[model samples]
Target: MEAGDIATWVGVLITLGISVATYVQSRRQARIADEANIASQEQVEAAQRRAVAVEDSLAEALRLLAERGLTEAPPTPAMSGGPGAVRWNLERRGKHSYLLRNVGTATATGVHVDRNRATPIVRNMPENATVRPGESLQFLMAPTFGNPLPGEVWVVWEGQPEAISVPLP
Candidate 1:
């Protein structure tokens, strides 16, 4: 071929090679970005699992502590206005009363107790009682209180941000 024709052909070949290389490079970059996104999602899921594990551990610790004993003295019935400051230990059996105890370090205020069922019946126990750290409160409920159907006590403590459902024996 003539020199001009050869040069034109060479230029066209070079431009086509550069375009193909650029496309390949872009595809490689997109794959890397997708891999990074998948890695980030996996990390987030792992973190969520860890958080759930931590919450479970804390709950178990609290249950163990409550089972052991109360660390502080509880307020009197008159001062407490009656039962409701703490949750009952379903493991404990009593002829006339359920064994209630406080497991938290701080006093639980505005305690509300409810018997769980299809239709929950809130106990008429004192709503503003305070249960001291590690203290037990004998809850004398009426109508011959029986074992909980679900084996759990729903308790709301004052000064606490949220309510806790404690498992019974």
Candidate 2:
């Protein structure tokens, strides 16, 4: 063959090599992207499961507390009130959370609870309640009450203001 033919053959081989390398790189990138997507989805699912667990635990604890008489509902105006039977005025947006004291000199006897059938959540209990007479407790709540249903908390707390707190779950 002529020198030109040999040169053309070499150019063809180089072009083919480049094309194969490009294809391989593209395939590798696609695999990496898929793996990343799967991992991200798994992380989101795990977070959701954790949120459910927290809500369930809260519900169970509240139920147990009620049974054990740890939780005391507010009494009627005539029945009379005690130091431990007072409601911590809550400014809750959603999900049962501990109160940041509004304006009172009362101590936290125990955390409040919301037992809505659709959504049931409970405030964090004091490990060893150290709330001062006028100071607020330092507990935060979930962004929203993830119903064990959804929107059921509003009903239970509404009918009995003395028995239950305001709408939280």
Candidate 3:
């Protein structure tokens, strides 16, 4: 091959290398952008979930303040697990009590899990003790474990799906 021909071939190889490098860089940037979009979508979904939870809590608070006569006395200190998932919070308003009985015709309930997450309270509740839908035996309010919880407290109660907190305090 002639010297001029060799020089021309070298120039062509350099241009091809530059083109391949540019393509690789562009592909890498595209992948990075895609990953960023996915992360942003997940964050949005999490925010939406938190917003819903807050809305439900607000609705419950409203219900507590609106009702007057329905809730004569406070209910039992509802027990639950985990950090955020609380069935009831009577820490500030003092200890609470409950005497739940089935109103429905032989509907199964009281099947609860133990501390180790086992089904220990399988049908723990007694038979139909005749607590009507609008009737409760003795949803009393007692003191806490040791202390008389004073001051303005922030107690949160989360009931079942079909249940709403009555006589909001």
Candidate 4:
């Protein structure tokens, strides 16, 4: 073959290689763009899920506050030390007394009281007791062992999903 013909064939081969390389590069770029788009969509979906969770949490918190306002007592101390003197004592030495007075408008039914975050004690409230408005219930805690720890009261009443917590003095 002639020198000119050989040179022309080499030029054609180089042109074909260049075209192939360009096509491969374009395909890679398209794949990269598709991956980026998928990642962006996943991020958006995650953010939407988080927002929905936050909204649900806020709704539950509002409902709990409303329930407490309707049902929980206003911590009215009953009169102690005979019938004439009006006094309320939560704790006195080894004897611990909790006084729960229902000052809300609604009556609390099936009231149960217990302590929380302390050594396991089997003391519970009276069975099937109901507290009307302006009425009160009393619970006593006497630790047989070590000194009493500052504890909280868990009050469960009827028609309420969560318990009402009262910290004792």
Model 1 worst lDDT run, 10 consecutive residues: 117-126
**Against the correct fold, how does model 3 do in TM-score?**
0.40
In model 3, pairs of residues that clash are: 64-168, 76-97
RMSD of each: 21.4, 15.2, 21.1, 24.5
Q: Rank the candidates by lDDT, best first.
A: 4, 1, 2, 3
Q: Alpha carbon lDDT of residue 110, candidate 4?
A: 62
Q: Give me the displacement of residue 29 in model 2, in angstroms.
A: 1.5
Best-matching candidate per lDDT: 4
lDDT at 94, model 3: 24
Q: What is the TM-score of each candidate against the true structure?
A: 0.40, 0.39, 0.40, 0.40
lDDT by residue (tens digit), candidate 4, 1-169: 9999999999999999999999999999999968966775665456446645755775687677778786643332221222322211233333554456665555555666544543344333333455555656554465556655446666666665576666667
Residues 73-155, candidate 3: write the lDDT tens digits.
33322222323222321111223433333333321222121212212221221222222232222223333445442222221
**lDDT score, residue 63, model 1?**
72
Q: 1 or 3: which has the higher lDDT?
A: 1
Runs off by more than 4 Å, candidate 4: 70-169
Candidate 1 local accuracy as lDDT? 0.55
lDDT of 3: 0.39
